[model samples]
Target: MTLRIRHLRMRAKTPAGPYGADIRFASGLNVIWADNTKGKSTCMQGMLYALGLERMLSPRREVPLPHAMTSFLKNDDETQLNVLESTVSLEIENGAKQVITVHRSIKNALVDNRLISVDFGPTLTDKTVRTERRNFFVVDGGAAKREDGFHHFLEQFLGWQLPLVRRYEGSDCKLYLETIFPLFWVEHDVPPKFHPAAS
Candidate 1:
């Protein structure tokens, strides 16, 4: 794969202040290590969300992040702050050396959650680069196949020509990213829930 992930950013606006995290990846293998529930999963989820690939995790369009990203954020002092808005952005480059930043709103007043904005250059890293912004839709019908879809945009960016596959229904269908992604990416199952009776 010629795709290189440059950066991932998650930000939230709160009355107390802004709570956010930024992660930059190196050229080679990248590893994220943190204690349980310390946002190791959140960073991965944020990248998926920014790329409009969250549907691979669920069919529902609801935000998959925890309350810390959607409803509230806790400060270092343990004070709770109400989150007014939250967003995630991922910077990526293809084999052609084309760099673009993809951004999505988790919860915001002005932007719809289903809308994704793409910058032509590395807006997160270099402010001097003048780039055009384009908007695309996800989670709705035909998002992967339609011309205006985010996945279609991504496929063009990555120079992918998905092949037709024979489904069980005896019909040919284009192999989607959700199906191909699992070959390389594996998302862990959620921790088992507690049950008093089982225990």
Candidate 2:
């Protein structure tokens, strides 16, 4: 599955930067070009929200960060951000392209932040079927549930018990990914790989 975001607006009542992040994702590749403390996390948070991740690790927040940052650009509407939108486009394997825009609103309190995503419009044949799954299992988010899938990180951090079914098969089990909705996969903060020579 692939996704693209364009012309997204995540405004606030302060002066920062983008209303939202402009990004795109293709065959296991994603990239974002943003400056320092421009609520880059906010736009990423929007994607996390759009992708439907129940738990999110907000970088840091005050004044509904997105809205607060947006307020800087907004002149006409001093008290509120005029528009906050995130647009996404996808190309299915069958060669069908679809676009979905989420018009968001952050007209609320800082302690009680809010993000409202509106399905702007799209060019697709089927409207009923959900093209994308929302259950976002991210690495940096938080804890995980056993039902979501056998999270090895949970096992590492906490502990794991083998199921009776697996035990019966004489399997001393260790599993990695559960739902495949990897939030960590997007992470590229890694040192270079290497192999040791035979001593």
Candidate 3:
């Protein structure tokens, strides 16, 4: 299925003030460009984080965002402001024209990071969509196959029936999203490798 990201937003509450970014994409190709350390990578990471795909970047359960998101952010005056809480939302559209908005808390006192809320409409783009909300869990066992699992819900939304693959122990397990995503998404932080041709 063709899945496209329609919008992405990252918000962080800080003592100095609120800091964040909101980006909207069109139907076709979209590119983000900015100067160094201007949150270009942060936006990309936020999208993955909101969709519970942060594990594509690492095997650790830790938040993949920079300190600006987890701890503090610097203002235009170069003063560091403590971040109280942070959240990210991603709006996406499937090939069938179905839209959904995913909300996740990256760092918050009240909300658990493992909980992901899904709105069954383009709530981020349209205010009157009357979207239905559902919650799912991630990072726990059976998250990829369980009914209440975020990845399982995501696979259904994308119309994907992942096949089981043989593991090292000769046991079969469904191909996890962590394994499939790397084939489609190229990370900005990892450098490319070059190998010489055999003589």
Candidate 4:
């Protein structure tokens, strides 16, 4: 399925104007370029924010949530309102063209309800392969653990659960990576054209 998000603010919401919180997303391959501080990454962030990734948020002045460190910088309260409103619109499913829109202020738990179903646990098991590749695993959240990447440790507390996801396809696969931080995060800087065929 293809996804798209629009109208999210990092520092502040879009000004009331002709194009409030304007953004466009393209399927297949999409690349954006611009000068520094021109909201290039911020635009991408808007989509991530709408997708419900907590740590990806830029942070408001105060109001903290679990694992979220609130900004405590001293500021003139009466003259400063740092609250930011963001809108996210996305299309899910390959060609279904279903669009959903969301608008809200920043919060500590900055993730979507459906996306929040990912879980990570150390004792998870798999269907086959003898369970020897004890890579710290992630399932759905709320029902499991957070803090991804088990860090390649000795057999003391590390063990394999085998990927419940056999081939890493569909929503089950996406949930697995989202909870444990997708492998793509490490390859974010790699150009797609230069990708190699390796495990």
Candidate 5:
């Protein structure tokens, strides 16, 4: 089964003001091109964060990268510190014409009193069909499992299975969609020395 993103919405409450982006994608080969500091990567990261896969973006960093929504929403001015609250919503459609809306937030904390919220539903406007955060995660032996929330749902919804492959010898590590997503969503990071050649 094929999966396609219908729409994406990101919103952040900042000291200066509210900031957000609404984007729509087509079926195939959609490209987001812009000059430096135009929020191209931010948009991509927001979508990933919305799906609870931001951690996979920088797996090897000493300190895991902050949530894309909250981190970038911070006020630049240090004089008056302001806590930024952010949210991301994604709408996806399957080949069977079933549409699902997933909403994740860094501000609202309802499930398990955690700062993160992950919820989804059949349609963007329908609230009665939404799923609770507690139901999103896999619970085994009366404890939350290490499995990802959104990834598990997508796998079952699309009937796709993720393979467990070793990165190297004796490595018991598993592969995730986040690790592989970068291959398709290539972001060019040209160094200062290579700027001329890139241009």
Candidate 6:
């Protein structure tokens, strides 16, 4: 199936008030080139954060770096405290004439309560559509099931079911979509020799 990203929007909260970054994608390969500190990585991280896959980019440490939402909202000095309220909205279209818009938000709260909104329609260009808000937390059989809200919608939209599989031998872990995303979206930090490792 063909999945195309039509647009990406990011809004950041900082001491200087809120700022936004809006991007539009075309049909073929899209290239983003700029000088150093031009927000290229920030923009890519925003898209991943929007898809609820920011954890893949975080380093394995005792205490992870600032949450993906707050990472980009820091001021130039990076000293003062700035509570970031970030939002990522993505418009995607499948080859089956189905288009979906997924919206996710990050807010400063005690419970880290994230919100997700999904919109579905016949095509990406459709103006009139139906939107729904999903609850990531659900209780089933007296057990709490905290599902990844954004990936759940993405699985349906892309018509691909992510099953539980062992990542390595004798490891009872499953491979997530985010775990394999690096194969498709290679970052610049990768060394030339390891470029073939993803394959």
Q: Pick the candidate with the highest lDDT.
A: 3
Candidate 6 C-alpha error for residue 183, in Å: 1.3
lDDT of each: 0.87, 0.37, 0.90, 0.33, 0.59, 0.60
Model 2 segments more than 4 A misplaced: 14-30, 54-95, 109-117, 120-180, 183-185, 188-199
Q: What is the lDDT of residue 174 in candidate 3?
A: 97
* Predicted model with the maximum TM-score: 3
Q: Higher-lDDT candidate among 2 and 5?
A: 5
lDDT of 5: 0.59
Sort by lDDT, top down from the best: 3, 1, 6, 5, 2, 4
Each candidate structure's TM-score, on Cα atoms with residue i matched to residue i, is 0.89, 0.36, 0.92, 0.38, 0.63, 0.67
Poorly placed runs, candidate 5 (over 4 Å): 60-68, 71-83, 107-135, 138-148, 164-175, 189-199
lDDT of 4 by residue, 140-188 (tens): 3332333432211111122323254545354442123234544333313
lDDT of 5 by residue, 28-66 (tens): 877777676657777777676656566556644221324
For TM-score, candidate 1 versus 6, the one ahead is: 1
Candidate 4: segments with Cα more than 4 A from true spot: 1-20, 56-95, 107-181, 184-199
For candidate 6, the per-residue lDDT at 154 reads 65
- Residue 38, candidate 2: C-alpha displacement in angstroms: 3.5
Instruction: Please rank every candidate by TM-score, starting with the best.
Output: 3, 1, 6, 5, 4, 2
Clashes of each: 0, 10, 0, 11, 0, 0
Per-candidate Cα RMSD to the true structure, in Å, reads: 4.9, 12.2, 5.4, 16.4, 5.9, 7.7
For residue 15, model 5's alpha carbon misses the true position, in angstroms, by 3.9
Candidate 1 worst ten-residue window by lDDT: 184-193
lDDT string, candidate 3, 91-153, tens digits: 999889999999999999999999999999999999888968999999888889999999999
As for TM-score, the candidate ahead, 4 or 6, is 6
